[model samples]
Target: MDNVISVILGGGRGTRLYPLTKERSKPAVPLAGKYRIIDIPISNCLNSYLNKIYVLTQFNSASLHRHITRAYKFDNFSKGFIEILAANQTIESMDWYQGTADAVRQNLRFFNQPNIDLVLILSGDQLYRMNYQEIIKEHIRTGAEVTVSAIPAERTQAEHLGILKVDEQGRIIDFSEKPKDEKIIDAFSVSPSVFDRHGIKAGDRTLLASMGIYIFNLDVLNTILKETRKSDFGKEIIPDIIKKRRVCAYFFDGYWEDIGTIKSFYEANLKLGSPSPSFDLYDEKAPIYTNPLFLPGSLINSCKISHSIISDGCFINDAEIQNCVIGIRSIIGKNTRIQNSIIMGADYYESASHIRANRFKKIPNIGIGDNSCIEGAIIDKNVHIGENVTIKNANNIEQLDAENYMIRDHIVIVPKGSVIPSNTAI
Candidate 1:
């Protein structure tokens, strides 16, 4: 691990997760009421003792840059640091990162260090806890030039993921990126014995889907990037390299979800409120790290809350919240009922003077107002929901884009800093 470096790809625009990605990069999106999406990967790296890291991004990176700078800092004694490498134009190339492979290609000069022997490539928008040293050790033992971490996924899950075909020696012989054709997917399915060898239950999940996690030998990474014009790792690099390089598959049967869409993001957040979540946040040995705000404890006044996670500095007065994730600095007024939603709490508390001014202007405060009903929605950071506002999509519309909100996959999303007037209904 001492000779390894980690690079988290945060370059995607995350169009599927729009509204959330409207102001910040995908990795900077808030998760589980407290931590950012980028924290998961960086925490995994730190826990694995692989500390030298670089985060590559291009779109809406101001918040991402700030969060990284504030959260991850190393003492001068240790050679551990986390740096953000935004897309830039050099004399050699004048374009932004075209794809994942191209993002790494553009930043090769930084990764081409003498002490770095192995490069770990990871996706920033995933929810998982992995000790990367296991994969690194396997890569070394198998003498694999490129190792891809794969998980057993069922047919429905494999259709959206990069499916792989592996030999008996665990070498990936073929790969397909999001193949919709049933024949192609079936051709890549692994046998039940494969799962047995890894001590995992097969259950209907016969195909091995790529987790978009990779461990590459530094020399091979340099050679491939220099020789090819491929832009993406899954769509181009991995598929092309399998025929020429020793690309192996490291089976990981853990809880992992690619938070790529509005629905997936909503469901993943709600899952955390369950009694036993698949992705554990209570693991002291491998705890997730985030910025410390030093906020006061929540003030709950007779609120009927159940199966919910309320963060720090919340003031809930006579509200009913169930199966929801209430973020930091949230305020819920009286008679409000919120269920199956994610309220990304405010960044700053409104001063008394500001609250009075807002009252004079007949504007709602920076939180849920009294007599509101919000269900199956994501109210982004710093949103102001006026009194008597109902946000439930009663019509069951699958997709819609309105002035203040948008519905995708049947979950309403109120973008950051939005204001919903009193008595508004959706």
Candidate 2:
């Protein structure tokens, strides 16, 4: 692991995520209540002792830069280093990242060092916990030029992922990028006995899909990036390399999700509050790390909270919060009901004097005001919801841009730093 380096690819524009990516990179988006999406892969790398990490981001990278710098810091004596490689224009190459392969090719200078043996390519906007040691060991044992992490997918799910076919020896034979034809999918289906041998129950899925996680031999990566002009790995480089290189698949039977769309992102965040979440953030063996905001515990006065996660430095009074995730420094007034939603909370706590002043001036401070019924909404940071506001989508609208908020997929989203007036109905 010491000789191996990890590169987490921050995705492009992230149009599918929309307003969530309006002001920040996809990786920098907050997760569960306090952690960022980038924390998942970085934490996995740290727990695996792969300390040399480089995060590649392009759009709206200011917040991503801040989070990476503040969250990861190793002692000067250790060789561990976590760095960010942003897109820049130089004399030789004056272009931003066109795709995933292009992003890594742009930062190939870092891999020129002599100590590097392999490169672990990871996606920043994914939720999963895995140990890379097993995959690395399999790569070395099989002498594969590249190893890709693979997982079985159901029929509908297989249409959205890179599907692959492997021989009995676990060597990749062919690949297709999201094949729609049922004949092609069934032709590449692996046997249930193959999954049984690996201690995985085949369940209903038979097709194996690439998890967008790959391990490349240092020399192999350098040669491919130099000779091939492939823009993407899954759609281009991988398909070409499998024919010429010794590519193998490493099966990972765990909870892994690509939080790419607004609906998926919203659902993934809410899943954290479930009684038994598939992905555990509290795993002591592989804990997720984030910027430690040392705030006081939440002070709840006669509030009824059920099946929700409340972060630190919150002041809740007589609120009924159910099936929601409240972020740090959240302030909720009395009789407010928040259900089936995610509140990102405030960046900084407002002083009592300032809140009093706002109240006197008939302005609401950050967070939900009294008697507001918010159902199925995502309230971003620094939002001031006025009193008696009914935020529930009354008409079941799919997409609409209101005065200070946006609705998508029948879910209302109050963007950051928005202010809703008192008694507003939606």
| Cα shift from native, residue 115, model 1 (Å) | 2.2
Best model number under TM-score: 1
lDDT (tens digit, per residue) of candidate 1 on 390-410: 999999999999999999999
Candidate 1, residue 388: lDDT: 96
Candidate 2 local lDDT, 10-62, one digit each (tens) = 98998887778888989988888888999999999999989999999999999
Against the hidden reference, what TM-scores do the models get? Answer: 0.99, 0.97
User: Total clashing residue pairs per candidate?
Assistant: 0, 0
Off by over 4 Å in 2: 352-362
Off-target runs (Cα >4 Å) in candidate 1 are none
C-alpha lDDT score of every prediction, in listed order:
0.94, 0.90
Backbone clash tally for model 2? 0
